[model samples]
Target: MIDTRRLRTLRAVADHRTVTAAAAALHLTPSAVSQQLVALEHEVGHRLLERDGRGVRLTAVGRILLGHTNEVLAQLERAGADIAAYTAGTAGEVKVASFATAIGLVVAPAMDTLRDKEPGIQVRVLDAEGDQSLTMVLDGAVDVAVAVEYRGAPGEDDLRLFRIPLYSEPFDIVLPRDHPLAAVPDHDGEAAPAPERDAEMPPTPEHDARTAPVDTSPASTHDPRALPVDTPPTPERDTRTLPVDTPPTPERDTRTLPVDTPPTSERGTRTLSVADLSGEIWIGPYPGNPCHDVIALACEHAGFTPEFAHSSDDFSAVVALAAAGAGVAMVPRLALRGTDLSGVVIRPVPGPKRRVFAAVRRGAERHPLLIPLLHALQDAATALRQAPSM
Candidate 1:
């Protein structure tokens, strides 16, 4: 067996044309380089070099061995490069579990970015609820889970998983386009029509303030937190396991109520209190969905209990119902961005917001395959924050 280290020394000596020069290149003494060449000749049973005056020159057999050494060294360099790239998280398939609209707003955009930036990474997306994605990550079923800040998700300090907060989005109220509040002045507390926007176009904060997503950008001056974006004001949720069950919040009365009469104080505003809607019918998410607890909790905090008269996990369906005048619905602003709002109006309050984040197993956050994907997901989230809802 030939020693690779000796072969490298032989190559360096050949190129440098002298053992002393090769020693300098290899950071070794001239005597050390000579010893390695001698060891190489012994390994192959050939006289690899001979003294040609003051300098050393390769023998016929030495030339033959040098050629093979060149090939071997080239391959070794190639192997080194490939291993480096593999460890850098620049190439591989990453499985991601996310809800649908996030697939559109965050996942899809992230996919485009990955395609351009790290084509070696293939991202497989699963359409899942926030809770489902959280479980998938913990069970090692997926490389990452893009989930909402729901009731059962692991906390940032949870030992079982690592969480990366990507962005926060406000929940918007869905109302029939003709709903009296739609005619009330917008969030500026003045009567005005919001500028229309296509789902693909970026939206301004002024429009989102009326009935869409609030800009959560670091550069944005709008203070979304100033509004109550969470229910229960300041409650702690246990996050050690999926589907955490706490004390039951009082069930909201979801029965049909006549909202036919516009408020006598029909002054338009950007924010609404859950108490104000206690008398109106409500459409909410079903129990298994991540958004369910948030909606229930937010209302409970506002001194009222609200429930789902109509429950569905699909925000599009929830919006459709609200458009049909079935009932009012609470929707994450991102979910509303891509849905048809022809007959619906969103009512945004200074209240509850859903936090979007990416999760990976305890130590997997640093996995090469996950690094780029996580970055792409985060960038997508930041872009979504700048985008307004319908």
Candidate 2:
């Protein structure tokens, strides 16, 4: 193969069309340029130049090599331009893999900033989860993956992995307006179960499923009792024969007034607790879906195993299910944007979240634009984390 430097010399000679001129362009002697060109010709196994008076002219083979060399040189120059632009934080394309939440709450906003400020740099986004995104980055499928890392999650920093700390979103519990709990007090000492009427409750089945209207009324927020179903009294047993050793009881005075009975509290009007919701239907992205971790945590946090009524990967489906009272679901704040789920409520949960990270191939540390993008991501993450509404 021809040495790169020798190729450079040949290209210069071709461009100048004279040994002396080419040597001057390359800061080399005419003899040195001729020698390098000769060496390149030998490596290609053919004569690259034709004899002419004073200087030399390119042969057909020489022209072909020059064509290829020109392309290579152009590519190198483009790469250099990309490098300069990246270092200045103003050019090159950034390939990114982002989770649904990050795409909206973080990536979208960052994209606007990148477009306005660094017009020369283009950004491409792929919607993906943290694990898959990281894998894609490590395999060179993406330049950077916006991954989450919950507290106590694993790490890859020692393997050339880097990360930016992004914002943390607290969970919320969604409830209807007339929910018995709404009538109850909040975390503050104030009384809950805000005084509301049955009209605020979700439309109760006069008993049909499909025609259900928007349940403007909230379910009781506090522990509400289930309406009791009358059970048939057990058949009374007949004891016709008395055993010979049976003892008799003493009789009481016939006319004594019966003690006043204590009045009973209303059972069906109380708020339903988590345990009372065992049979409630639920909705989610999919079975065992990672995005639903917070939903599961919320259910477990609320002291019940969530009864999922339907499953789908589409965010819209989850929202739809929640709208129909199929069951409550956990959704990224970004995914919830612009969606009107009039009856669905957002509730906060404690100690529940997902974690993510930024990943790239093992040897990509030296990539010309990779470093710049990584730094930008880190800075953006810091700003996002410190911003309000996290």
Cα RMSD (Å) per model?
A: 23.0, 28.9
Best by TM-score: 1
TM-score of each: 0.59, 0.48
CA error at residue 198 for candidate 2, angstroms: 25
Candidate 1 Cα deviation (angstroms), residue 278: 0.7
Question: Each candidate's lDDT (Cα)?
Answer: 0.64, 0.50
Q: Evaluate residue 117 in candidate 1 and report its C-alpha lDDT on the 0 to 100 scale.
A: 84
Displacement of residue 85 (Cα, Å) in model 1 is 7.0
Evaluate residue 264 in candidate 2 and report its C-alpha lDDT on the 0 to 100 scale.
13
Per-residue alpha-carbon lDDT of model 2 for 1-390, expressed as tens digits?
568788778766765578887787667898888788778878999899987887778899888887777556544434554466457554568789987766775577767766665567688999986366765553345767776653223364323233433433332334444444434444454543321222112222231110111112342221111111123213232111111122222121111111111111111122234443454666666544455665666567678888776777676667656656556555544355455545554433333444434554433433445544544454454444333322
> Please, what are the lDDT tens digits per residue for candidate 1 over residues 252-328?
11111112122222223245666667767889888877788888888888887785689888888998898788988
Q: Model 2 segments beyond 4 Å from truth?
A: 1-91, 150-160, 176-183, 187-280, 297-304, 314-316, 333-335, 362-368, 378-390
Number of clashing pairs, model 2? 50
